[model samples]
Target: MESSSEFPTSPSSGTTAITNPGFPVSDTVLSGASLPSPPERTSSQGGGIPLSKTASNVSSHSHRQSFAENQRHPPPSPRTQRHPSFTQQAIQDLMNHPPPNRHQNPRYVGRDWRDVAVGELLQPDEVKWAELDMSIQEATKTLFQSSPNNVVLVRQDSSSKEAMSTFDHSDLNAYLLAVVGLAKPEEEQVALYRDISVKAQSQEEIPLRDLQPIFRKEELVKIPAESTLDKAIEVFGGGVHRILVTNKDSEVVGILSQLRLLEFFWNEAVNFPLIDRLYTIVLRDLQIGTQQIIAVNADAPLADALFLMSSEGLTSVAVVDNGHNVVGNISTVDVRHLTNANSLPLLKASCMHFISVILSERGVEHGRDSFPVFYVNPYSTLAHTVAKLVATQSHRMWVVESASPSPSAPATPLLQASSSLPPLSTLSPPAISPGRTGSPTPGSATVVVPPPGAITTSTPQSPSTQGPFSSVPASALPGAGLSGRLTGVVSLTDILNLFAKSSGLRPLDPSEQRARRRRSSSSSVRPTLDIGRENGRGSVDSRR
Candidate 1:
């Protein structure tokens, strides 16, 4: 909710003006090849217990009558049941007398979720590591080089065996705050902001251990490898981003992220009828995610946006124009670009320019504009949202007001079900120019202003201009067509939490400790120990 007007537009002693380059469009297009195909349905697979035809023929009237009869004479408890396995018996009971609206049940529909184990969803490659004494610059480079694995476990020193903390993109906010001198006393903070060029030079030498007060070094959530998927869901629903999987010896085995679990649900949805059905429900009907949005103006200094994210404990902030329309997005992940010495001056650039530079850098590095523009509207289906998240490899989606009018529901609610899962390429709407009234056409070229007293060039530039501080047109960007005001943000956590809630699973309270379950003596399935050690820190080479 911070406004651009609250911050000064230019430095007090310098005549250099921060010019507003039009919004840069994201050029990345999602490809379906990356998404796993939905697995074929089978009776025994995915915890599905096939019901007999006779059982399926029972009408709702008889179901209600049976419920009343059960109320009069309650059935025998599990202890007295014929089935030896309590879990099997419970699943049988659920299958025999399904809830009228299975969506309301605490268990997954058509599947015995207890059969799924936490080890099945873990990706060993995601485990990266860093040392406490490593300079922020070196750590930043390590994190960026690690790619998809955004977090790294931190050790106290090279000789230490156990990880003492964690460092991720979110921690970059604290580093940025230090660079701008915002962590200093209020009297000294103003002077630091006035001349950021001098302060940026000193930040690289600071070590990771120096920012311990602001770093999210809390104990990583741990779960036994043998634990059920439902337990993982419960922990994830509680707002934990990733959980470390451990073995009987209490050593780390692997890591499970919220995105990985969501991907599991997405790829295997066909086997779980309830989850598959839930996917068709539009975001508005489910009422998932928070509407309390934290954002910054497109013209605000990139440093200001990072400060807002750091102070508010947010991973990303929506960039909006004076009219409140979402023009761009800035997240902690983008902070990786600032670690490069040449890109450091961008801290003083406008957020819009920062986004432009990011896209340009990515376009050059990847040989294509691969940074996706992630946003959704009320009418977007849960399946669409999940697909986009997985496809873009992003953590959240900005909820924007739909440019079109709301559609009326069909006579049969089930008819609203999507015939097929929409591809990620279809999620991005057409690009529309973003800014105050009378904005340029979507095809208009980006305008870049030179530094004070710099000579202006007369040469015409291409639509896809590349530079350290130049902007690109909407036509060349992938997500430029997402037009409307941002309403809220739906993160991977929000989506996972919704699934947990619909399954009747309660979120683990902060005060409650997650009990780690041990592998049963009767089971012979032993999880493979895949934890890797490298450079005196634990790490795994990720296939992603």
Candidate 2:
């Protein structure tokens, strides 16, 4: 990947008005662009007072013209108007007409945002691949082992070399749902699958092809690798989480995730004065993200949180307690823990307990607590938020109210455990044994593993015993001192959208687009006025 300092020179500056090819012109006038003139009307057509006609005739003619003109051309509907501001127009023009020599320009300098290409910032694609004939167990293992924890399934005999589908956390959720005998009824599953019936089965023997219904076959959003960063931002502004970077032949070369984009911006922020200014603004002043939060109770079954994620189309959900304090977080990525035979029973564990187990697993597997609790307050600066997001590799940060520290109490780390739950460092490694089969029955004993060096009790403790916030003191819970009540959730998408808006290129609202489409369809069916000359006379004909 190209470093921030290696970018080429920005496009030359000028007052030259350039046409935007692919981007839709917004409903407001762009800076430096001429305002469009209103539709033309004729006095003879009754649009204005007829100078050659009688007073009575003029009155009636003007009324008719006004109605006809209004019907034919509505007065600059917001959907049809062009509203690209000066900054947006400049960015679009830059993208439409780039310099001939991207690297050799005499004025070329490092870290010029305008000259950066999506391909220049793209990192190596870490996505793994699996054959359709691969067993679910093998595929799951491969997926978890991969960095991004996703796999592309392809046909062995296919000639196009295109991926048949993708398998990710969502697919794992479905498979696990079936394994636990909690698969949705056939009627409810209709929208998810076509013909295959998913049922509780052994992952070791089932080929991925048999579970085609669970594969994500949605069309992958892609962009040309050579496209400018502005174009990528435009696509992302439409709510896409990531886009596949494609080469000239349309073959996907790399993936640009929301996190990766933000990381790049954070790294190169010093080079761009505008971005640096944006970073200093507090989140409350910008009000960038949605206030509505979708969360799961910390005491709810871990599976419930995963199901909620799948249903709500969320990558993660805030795990909160009864008072709505964010206690922890659970994400689709955590589903990887279930692939282990020893961890399968955690499906029915409380979300908090499940979180503890996953944290412990991370320490054992990766030698540290990979999952860190991250939160920010409304007063937090955008720079702080971005720094935390990039540092933790988290898609979001829980926005909590700023808590007033007590004079008597000393400050504690954000991840500090309350008396109810043991500290993460004291957790021991989970005991992995062989011969585990089928999903654990209800009321089965769930072993909560602590990190190495933790004291273990002789008697095995259930997940409920391990950690349930109901009995814990409020003052002892995580975020008790440094954070307050949960207010909202800010995500990577929100930050990216803000950047796009700052450039005067606001994301197109889906609802507005839908309304525009409706109006267009309706107009196509409406009668249109066709003017023609016949028999040495002018006539207006209404045609559908």
Candidate 3:
């Protein structure tokens, strides 16, 4: 990595923007870009002028989170990665540091505010793919020694882009996360599947216009220009994790996140490394390693979303309406109470809830549980991905590429994880192992690995078949079918999960990536928690 002096110090200032890195960074933005006005808000959609960012702030036994909900939507691209002065050396320093430790943590002690630039150290692009595809085990045991969930991603751009995710309904998925059916007293799995049946029976899908607006730009909060991190949070309430930085024309130019702000307080041994003092990187080449986004549309038929959660396997989605603005958020937890297993057999006819249970959190062999979506720009380093989880409290983040011509960007798994995925037959649900034979899988299916091009665009009949981000089997379930162009139904939220499967969020096998790491260690700064405490802290785990 090289070094530079042009990086922006504040999250909301005029910095580079975040861009989708899935496509080549050098690739120009698709030609027809224009300012599309927000569509009209719908009836079922109530408006509170967007809640004060703090109003929606969710607090828990150990953590607290809030962000500006009404903040304007910044342009898809951020200025952080595009600044003229951002260089490779700065990016290296950012990558070397983990999220929680990047900023000189005011919550704890030790470390300097000057050296504690929260979002700097980023991983080189060459190692990015290796990091995301590593399994949870590999990420924790090898790549980073922090809580397997708290590493960060670093980028090559001098902008020092940072990313992370937040859980909308973390509790909903927690119960089913670790325990298996054998924990009878806690045997909530099957019952959980049955509860899904109840929710479906009572709700129905509606048009996008029927939702309520969550927050409007500045309606709930304000981001003072380059403001101190603490003040920013209070003004935003707690929900404003990311604040959009727009230009005089109200055109979005950049963004600031709560996680990034928090980084200002924590610091340790994390530092950037570089072979040279300066190098230029493109916007796509610089971005947060993990991204967290929320989807909500108040008018959505509760049943439709529940089915979506299970079928697509998402923890939560930031629902929106016709105008492309977020509405009241719904999460896995909302659907859980609706799909209670005890309520399933009672109704007997609620097939929707039954299948939802099978889908929401279950995996092929065993239910892997649900996770909040992490948004990524595709250009972050392995270190960035690790850091995002820690600062934002997440295990995974979704990577969004460019926006589509707008009716809405369908969540189609259009891209490939790599060129080596197995055949679609191998990916078939029925082919899944006996370990899950009795599980409440939505379609009672087993998926075998499929060929690389199994779901390519050559087959035009695949309405709703998102190219690479979200791939719905031509027929995932019996009645879960679609019509033309799949429109809003094929949302990026759910499609992102499918993309994870295709893009290799969890590599089927990563011995190779691990081997590559060993070989490159001499030249790279692979920070490890295994060594011991940094300064004033207890053992690493206890301190964190």
Per-candidate Cα RMSD to the true structure, in Å, reads 23.3, 27.2, 25.5
Report RMSD for candidate 1: 23.3
Off by over 4 Å in 2: 1-114, 148-160, 185-204, 215-218, 365-371, 403-482, 510-544
Residue 410 accuracy (lDDT) in model 3: 18
Q: After superposition, how far is residue 61 of candidate 3 from its true place, in Å?
A: 76
lDDT of 1 by residue, 1-544 (tens): 0000000011235223222122111212332111112244432222223454665655545433344455676544432222213432342233223323434233444566545878877765666778988866567656655555577767777755355666877776555554434432133333432233233443325566655544533335666788777777876776667777777776666778877788788767666765678877888998887676656666555666776665545667777654345666777876655543434456655666676555444433433333344677788778777766766666788777773121110010000112232211122111223542221222122222222234545522323323344433333333233346667778877887777777887865422221111111112221222332211122332210
lDDT of candidate 2?
A: 0.51
Q: Which candidate is the best by lDDT?
A: 1
For lDDT, candidate 1 versus 2, the one ahead is 1
lDDT of 2 at 408: 14
The candidate with the higher lDDT, 1 or 3, is: 1
Worst 10 residues of 2 by lDDT: 1-10
TM-score for all predictions?
0.58, 0.59, 0.24
Runs with alpha carbons beyond 4 Å of true place in candidate 3: 1-111, 114-283, 287-397, 407-437, 440-544
Which regions in candidate 1 have their CA more than 4 angstroms from the true location?
A: 1-111, 157-161, 184-206, 217-219, 403-482, 509-544
lDDT of 3 by residue, 1-544 (tens): 0011111112234322221222111100111112223344443222334334465544342231223432343323322233221233333355434434334334333533223322232212312111223222222122222221122232223243321111122212222221111111123334432332232233322111111111011111223233332333332222223343323333223344433343322233232122011112211443222222323222333333443343333444433332222222234533233222332221122222222322222211121211122333234443443343333343233343421112111121111112222211111111223654232322211112122224434321211211112222323322122111111221211222222332233311222322332232122122221111133111212110
**Model 2 Cα shift for residue 71 (angstroms):** 78
The clash count for each model shown is 9, 9, 123
